[model samples]
Target chain A: MIEFHLNSRSGLSPYQQLVQQVRHALRLGLLREGDRLPTVKDVARQMAVNPNTVLKAYRELEHDGLVAARPGVGTFVTRTLADDTLAAQGPLRKDLRRWLAKARLAGLDDESIEALFVSTFRSTAGEDVA
Target chain B: MSAVLRARGLGKRYKKRWALQNCDLEVPAGRVVGLVGPNGAGKSTLLKLACGMLTPTAGTIEVCGGRPAAGVEQLAKVGFVAQDTPVYAALSVADHLDFGKRLSPGWDDAEARDRIRRLGLDPKQRAGKLSGGQRAQLALTLGIAKRPELLILDEPVAALDPLARREFMQDLMEAVAEHELSIVLSSHLVSDVERTCDYVIVVVDSQVQVAGDIDDLVAGHYRLTGPRRDMDALPAGQHVITASHTDRQTTLVVRTDTAVHDPSWTVDPLGLEDIVLAYMARPADAVRDTRPALEVVR
Candidate 1:
């Protein structure tokens, strides 16, 4: 069973939040191909959202080529964000980790580093960054 | 799909006062539509009319494409749970379920029994002894098992504690998923509606302020804050729903999908509650600037 959760206070709509959660889980290796997503009825009951809202999330996921539904069975995670890009991101993560340690040693606090990261991230095209 | 509930020029007057006036609205089928507004906003009046409890003084209301409460067929198409979540206090839990089965031609006996069991309700316990939340559960079970094509609930969870409220709404969502029923739930608590309903109807001062799909409504409304300026300068498309002003600045909540081109105004997307509160806060006496009514795209 999917341990799904939603933050009603978040600015994002419920369906959009569910989509992002599935995407995040895929990226973090928490879910993968052939993994069955929780049924719409279960998520709606557990999360207290309309079943159509959950269906909308599943539809969007299918449109993005991340999931699919079988006639008699439940929806399944069909794929994740490009595996090649994820592989490519590994070394960049290592480099960023080392640079973050240096920045900390040079007295750069987390807030300042975060502010710098946000500004840089915002100025460039955000595609494939997540 | 055809509208499940449609009302045109609907009104109900009490002596000289109109409880609801010129309330033209349509609720789409198979959606959980919420009716929201402050007390005395005619939310109850509109719901009562939909259920055919009160005759409309001005116009008409139809449920499932037929006149509300016209006959046994019409009556069977709509179910109602009023503000108090009324259940016979003297009846035992099992007796209440049994009564519902006998009274409603379409009642699902097994489902009603299963709901009671799942709620951990004692079948032999009298309704008078059940807690407020428990009674509400029993009422909702009856409402759902009655299996009307549409269910109208008036503030069913208002008396429940936080956890109980969550459980109640969860059960409602589950019921909606399982049954082929449309729900029109009325609530003053925007938070409850925000979590439970997909469509929204905002009533204010005995009139329909706005009604539409929740996601579309939220996307179209925005708060624009900027330096002190006259309202007349805003573009014709930017219709103000409500405005608050200070000496140095003005913050106007407007309903429009047009992109804001002016750099001076900071435009922010509104959450459901913010948009609802803005509509409820509108001064009823104002001329309401002849902006077009929200198109009920049913």
Candidate 2:
């Protein structure tokens, strides 16, 4: 079972956070197809969040075709996101590590490195959309 | 959708002073609703009115599809845990459970005993000796085991420490999930409300300022910062809730159902706390012309 935790400082709503965490886990291969999610009551009791928030998150995931709920049973993952990108992660991690080392050598601090990476990623992604 | 609580021009007066006035609200069933405002902002008055503990001087209120506390049946449909989580000081935990079983026709004896055990509360310990958190839990147990359709709590965790507070909220949420219970809890702590409630009611200066689903409220409200300009020149759809201006910039929190397309202004989405605070910060006597028609209908 995948345990859900909320980051209050993240600015995302609780439901959004839950949806994102499930996607992140799916992409990371930590959660595979057929894995049952923790019950709404379990999540609400453990996380101290409104059960409605958990229900909304699960519904959104089901709407997105990532999970499905069986009446009287529990919600289960129906899709795995790790197929396409997981294979490329190793090379991407190596490249990112190299880039980080080079940036440090050039005297860029962590914050500057993050800002540069984010700006470059955004502009490139925007161009691809256009 | 049926409303668990409805009020129309509801007002309460204490002889010479009006504690709450011109309040109108409709809270839908099966949702966790939070009532929030500053101290003495009539949050308690509104909750009390819904439970029929206080008679309205001006208008009517309906709870659980009937006048609150109208009869034994109506009373059975509503459970109230007042401020500071009042419990009978002279009664033991076991005594309280027995009292609940004897008094409430729908009392869930197994559930009551299970909760007391899970809370690690000694059945024989007198409520007068329980810690604040424990007392709150015991009171909540009674409230929940009574099997009311709606549970109304007034600042239930105001006296709890941070850890105890978290525990109490967890239990409450669990109860909601298991029993399909509707809850109306009041708290001045916006963060608690943000995490624990799907619907929110903001009371300020003895009036109902705004009420809506939390998501809609957050989505409809925006913070815009731009060059100083006349507030009256804004688009008709944008209703200013609060505004501040410096020599060069005007910052405003506004409510609008449409997108803010003004290229010159930077629009930022607000968190639940920020939205509530913006409403609370609004001047009590601010021009009603700028205020959006109260959207409590939903």
Candidate 3:
């Protein structure tokens, strides 16, 4: 089961937030194939939202082939976005963390590190294309 | 889906003053519809009519496919908790539960007791001594225990503190799930309505200013900010709900399904609160002749 945390103040609709959470969970491996999702009624009651909102989110998930709903049973995850690149990124993540620690030690703040990463990445991608 | 509550040309009058007039509404099942308006916007009048508590002066209201207050079976299909969440102050909580079980047909005694226990309210406590929030919870329990197809709540949490209000709403959603019931909850708070309601009915000055699914309503309304431009210059599809202007620029909240592609304006989607308040701020009487399209639709 996936736990949905919605920020109503985030300017996105509640259903959209729910849909995104499911997708994010799937992408991050928090949710995987064969995991059951809570019924629309349960999610609505727990979140104190209109039930139709949950239905909409579930419908979007089903449309994306991330979930499948049985007639008498609940929705189940059928697919996930985790692929080979994501699965092989463990060492890359560890190295990036070490680099980030070094950058912070060198007095580069998070904003500067993020800016440097974006510009560097964009340039590298452009060079690859060129 | 079948509508649990339907009204056409629904009107109610007191002496010469019209409380509500020419209102047409259809509330489909499986929705928590919010009836929102100001104190004098005829929200209570409409609810009372649907509950069969008051007769209409000019129109008709039907609840559960039958006229309200029409007969015994008709009254059993819908439950109503009016403003102030009236409970027998003299009775103990246990006594109130007993009374509810005896009075309401299709009463679920175990469900009521379970809810009471979950709320952690003492059964021996006197209703008069319970806090406003507790009393409201008790009232809701009675209404939900009746197990009606549709439950009508009129500002059921207005008197509670913020925490109590939230808890009471939480109870409502739980009851909705446990019983598979549709609800029509009325409130003056836009935030509460936006949080819990899928459908909205905005009443302004004895008229329904707007009634639609909140998703559609929000998608249609927008705040367009741009350099000052004449209203006549805008396209016909853009029906302005409210407009404010400055020396250099104009901000208009308009309701339109058409895609806004105007290069000069920055179109921003309005939130539910903004959309509701926009219609409320500009009553039909205030802008009757200004827009023929709005009038015609109304």
Candidate 4:
């Protein structure tokens, strides 16, 4: 039921793109635990991709514990990760730390940074001002 | 990886012409192999012969260690998805499965149902009402769910859109992995082959121009661009697949198991598509003098 277009020109491989989209959906709570996924063939048909590409994405998701496949049944979203899961989120925390350090080094004061953050939020909230 | 399919001294002829001449190939099992060529290069005919749909005019072919044309056991172990996605248009998706269940001895109903549900396809949907992409999926479902040891797909994604094509290949790769099946598919799309296949067979001028694992083929073949020299003087191990000459230089694609470090030519790696085109571009009679070795024991 999730609808998203894969950008052919994107730097990410097709499998990575699918994994990102699915992760994004999970973050937004759009996809709940026990939610069924389209068959690899079905997604390929809908997106006009080779089934192998979808399989790759599904395999990644399965490896990440976000999805699980039943031999006689279809794949479904797994339940939420354990609290200790964050202990294993090494790459994500490293990326966040790097981005924050870069933002701090950009020479903006704390007040200016907060102001910039508020304005950025307002723009996405339907504000007319640029 | 055992030799699942073998073709020795295989040749085919039309009324007054030879389509494929003295072709020899041995394909290992549980690997994804690609057959590439231009139109009228006899790629489809080669697949037909492998599937036992057409009789070879000369030489012999064996599928899964047995003669394909002689019996149904070998043919049954081999599942063929032809150039066109041939399915019963009037039948429903469920009916197609039912027919497969009735006809195929090794049909896996659980796998078929799981795949169908994952794709969100209704069993009652008629094949004729399905879209082009859907028809292709259905054809694959039928062919793959039969649990054949060797799956031969002929241009299964050629008619699909770019996105659809990628998805179809992804699905195919997953199936190959899950079933542990050997696949030999034919296509003109190089990019698709690059992504999905590990082995390659180049068909040109009605013959198997070259066949090997892709990594080995690419690593072994070299494109040398430099001043012209007598190719007869080249070492015995270096076999020239194609040679093009300009005013002051000669560009040649050569196959050698050993590395060539000659100072006269700059040797560069060759792409699968480049090697395939080199063979397809050759004239039909150009290499007639180099007769194929015909000491096929099988």
TM, chain A, every candidate: 0.74, 0.77, 0.66, 0.61
Cα lDDT tens digits for candidate 1, B183-266: 999988887787778999988889888889988888788888999899999897777888888999999998776666677886
Candidate lDDT scores, in order, read 0.86, 0.91, 0.84, 0.76
**Which runs in model 3 stand beyond 4 Å of their true positions?**
A84-130, B286-298
What TM-score does each of the candidates earn? 0.90, 0.92, 0.85, 0.68
User: What clash pairs does model 3 have?
Assistant: none
Clashing pairs for model 2 are none
Considering summed lDDT, which 10 consecutive residues are worst modelled in model 2 chain B? B288-297
- Per-residue CA lDDT of model 2 for B1-298, tens digit only, reads 9999889989999888888988778889999999999999999999998898999999889998999889999988999999999988999999999999988989999999999999999999999999999999999999999999999999999999999999999999999999979999999998899899999999988888889899888878899999999899899888899999999999999988877777688777899999999989998876356434565237
Which has the higher DockQ value, candidate number 2 or candidate number 3?
2
Instruction: Pick the lDDT winner.
Output: 2
True contacts kept of each: 0.71, 0.76, 0.40, 0.13
| Error in Å for residue B118 of model 4 | 1.3
Per residue, candidate 3 scores C-alpha lDDT tens digits across B138-164 of 999999998898899999988889988
lDDT for residue A14 in candidate 1, whole number 0-100? 82
| DockQ per candidate, 2 decimals | 0.48, 0.57, 0.27, 0.07
What is the clash count for each candidate, in the order shown?
A: 0, 0, 0, 23
Q: If both were scored by TM-score, which would come out higher, candidate 1 or candidate 3?
A: 1
